[model samples]
Target: MGISQSTLFRELRRNSSPAGKYIWFKAHDKAMERRKRSTGNATLAPN
Candidate 1:
């Protein structure tokens, strides 16, 4: 069976907030940088 819209919303609400504010922002920035590096093929190119 498929998940209901309300259930999905509730799940998103549950995990969206982080307890540590600094850690949350730091993690978000790190994740974005990691995505950019991976998608830009930085590892494949020579330094």
Candidate 2:
């Protein structure tokens, strides 16, 4: 179908705290940071 359960779980696992808590706000920040990082690298790579 669409996104798989495993993919969602993997993202949650990666974004979780060291103590294994999934706080949505922190996860959102992490996701945004990751997006910016990937975008930066992609832009730089074209040079």
Candidate 3:
């Protein structure tokens, strides 16, 4: 909710269903999947 409106719009557009409906569970899953894929190296690297 602290995100900018444009960012919120972009995320909804990216993760929403085919019907253009936003689902929390589906969106969260999609975000987690993307993070998992994109953070592979980051997760392995030492902080």
Q: Against the true structure, whose lDDT is highest?
A: 3
User: In angstroms, what RMSD does candidate 1 have relative to the true structure?
Assistant: 8.6
Tens digit of per-residue lDDT, candidate 3, span 6-32: 998898899999999999999999988
Per-residue lDDT of candidate 2, residues 1-47 (tens digit)? 48999998998899899999999999999989988878453334564
* TM-score per candidate: 0.35, 0.64, 0.66
Query: Residues 1-47, candidate 1, lDDT per residue (tens digit)?
Result: 39999986655554455752344566567667877878563466678
lDDT of each: 0.61, 0.87, 0.89
What is the alpha-carbon lDDT of model 1 when measured against the actual structure? 0.61
lDDT value, residue 27 of candidate 2: 95
What is residue 3's positional error in candidate 3, in angstroms?
Answer: 3.6
Task: Kindly report which residue pairs in candidate 3 clash with one another.
Answer: none
Number of residue pairs clashing in candidate 2, backbone atoms closer than 3 angstroms, sequence gap of 3 or more or interchain:
0
Where does the lowest 10-residue lDDT sum fall in candidate 3?
38-47
Q: Give stretches of model 1 more than 4 Å off.
A: 1-22, 40-47
Tell me model 2's lDDT, rounded to 2 decimals: 0.87
**Where does candidate 2 stray beyond 4 Å?**
1-3, 40-47
